[model samples]
Target: MTNLLDMRNLVAGYGYGPDIIHDFNLQIKKSEVKCIIGPNGAGKSTVLKAITGVLKPRSGAVEFEGKDIAGKEAYQIMRQGICFLPQERAIFPNMTVAENLKMGTYSLQDKRLAEERIHHAIETFPVLGERLHQLSGTLSGGQQQQLVYARAFAIQPKLMLIDEPSLGLAPALVEQTFQHIANIASSGIAVILVEQNAFRGLEAADYGVVMDLGKLVFEKPANEVLQDQRIRELYLGKAAKQ
Candidate 1:
């Protein structure tokens, strides 16, 4: 159970503003799904930003695969076997599904390997395969998110930082989306998930982390954390206990 990604004493913020994520520490093992849960402005997404190089850490280390990647740029981080899917649907509206998948492999130098990955993505997500020539913008919200997931997987990253995959989706779509993510984790790529839907996130996660006001407040197995009365009451509201 070696750590794939480790953030130690991380302090990061936007621009000249004060630090939003303070002394953040996290370690994710290979093939594990670690879900981060908290209310809005809890710096949950900020942690992902620091790891993915959207914002640089003012101090501390971001170690991926035993190498310190603290100050690397976003592309540099991606080259190191990590890819990020932001909260937003990042697909190109004008591009076809097949073309969007091709865009995801821009970093890979091997044409054959990239093509292999594309085929694998299509196989894993058959919807994308069936609609390869369809305009990505014309797809439903859930389909677009699925496309984003498929595109991220096209690079065959060892670790994926996914921000709010369920955002703006209906309940059934949210369930489908999490199942897709769970399937990805089951295939051995470590995932650090920032989720607004606490219940489902915990349900799908192997490990659960709770953050508040720029720091971690709780950490445990996802099931244990979900059943904790204190956590249930504090973050998930009173109905969680019933």
Candidate 2:
């Protein structure tokens, strides 16, 4: 595949074998921030799951870095330099912020190497460094989300799959969260960001793909797609500018 990620002719769904995502095709370049946006129940999250191996595609290929990764296990994908950060709150409530980040690198065989990555992660997220000793459960909602992201980064995956990054945060916090995601991409990691903040998601993405009833309705450069009236109406449920 010419892309870092290529999902072609993919059809996947939850158990019933009825594909919620049918005939989907998407390709993301290396080190790019690609965001998927659509209305609720539009199968946006499912696409992330499929890419992360949380849900297997019934047919078609999910190629990553030239290998077909379809049907592989989640941890296997992680080992191959891809990590998925779910929209759900995933922090260890009782663990200190630093401890949670440490847990992420537990599987690495090299302790010193792991520490090196941890140092990098903390430096990238200084707020996390400040909260090193604080219990994760006690942090603010945005802080908790940041912790989850920090933990994921500790694994040092080449690809990061993010789902609904701004789902429940206040508007101000949401902006901060998206800003962090942008930085993650800028740091040379390929990010597949699935978000409900369509306008902001589109703005943050290097490329944008619109989903409608589980199908990819359109894919275009972020700026160009945002200006497409039909794409906006189909997924945003609003009339677009002329």
At residue 98, give the lDDT of candidate 1.
98
lDDT of 1: 0.91
Candidate with the greatest lDDT versus the true structure: 1
Candidate 1, residues 1-242, lDDT tens digits: the string is: 68999899999999999999899999999999999998899999999999999888999999999999998999999999998999888999999999999988999999999999999989888988989999999998878988998898898899998899888888898888888898889889999999887887888899999999999997899999898888898877655966
RMSD versus native structure for model 1 = 1.3
Mark the 10 consecutive residues where model 2 has the least summed lDDT. 233-242
- Which model scores highest in TM-score? 1
Query: For each candidate, what TM-score against the reference?
Result: 0.96, 0.92
Model 1 alpha-carbon drift over 4 Å, by segment = none
In model 2, residue pairs whose N, Cα or C atoms come closer than 3 Å (at least 3 residues apart or on different chains), thus clashing, are none
TM-score (C-alpha) between model 1 and the true structure: 0.96
